[model samples]
Target: MVTSPEEMQNEANKKFCVVVGNTVTGICTTSNAPADAKCTATDPGKVTVTSVPSDHLTILGTLSTTNIIMANWSKAMWQSVVNRAIRMLAWGPLGSHFFSAFATVN
Candidate 1:
């Protein structure tokens, strides 16, 4: 039984490669987790699953679904960084110049 979110995601990572049945999908990589559970990926795509924490109890015979949202965690993170940089530029004296530079790269 997994006690924390980290352990839960680790288990999910092991199963990520199996999301597409017996075929190998993407290369599995550890990434950010969900608010309530862990998330991992395989190949170029990610497969997310939710698990009940060891400290939490659930009734038997309940159905649980694993919804795979197609979003690149790494890309999101970099986008966040880029947003912050833009904000900094907008707030500073050199805001216009740097903001234009960053925008042009997009």
Candidate 2:
């Protein structure tokens, strides 16, 4: 007979398998998960989900605007960003008039 305790198990009551700290050892939890999980040195890009009753917010995407005024505000913010980028380019070794040329092209 063989026993493999390393394998993760999510029973009806327990629904999460998460590493506590920097160690490879993990624990199972039945408690509610945080809104955003923490990242560790070993796993810097991913997070561990403690519990999930349902897949409600699995596909969170970009910000969305519904009103006309908010849409215009977004456009204004984007234009400002473009202008700033152009101004920064003007300060580069190219020349001080780079922003003017960029403004004309863009």
Best by lDDT: 1
The TM-score of candidate 2 is: 0.23
lDDT of 1 by residue, 32-58 (tens): 433323233243344444443434232
| C-alpha lDDT of all candidate models, in order | 0.45, 0.43
Position 38, candidate 2: lDDT? 29
Cα error of candidate 1 at position 83, Å: 0.6
**Quality of model 2 by C-alpha lDDT:** 0.43
Model 1 alpha-carbon drift over 4 Å, by segment = 1-73, 96-106
lDDT of 2 at 69: 72
Where model 2 places Cα greater than 4 Å from the true spot, the runs are 1-73, 96-99, 104-106
lDDT (Cα, tens digit) per residue for candidate 2, span 34-72: 323323223432333444333532332355568887666
Listed in order, each prediction's TM-score against the native is 0.23, 0.23
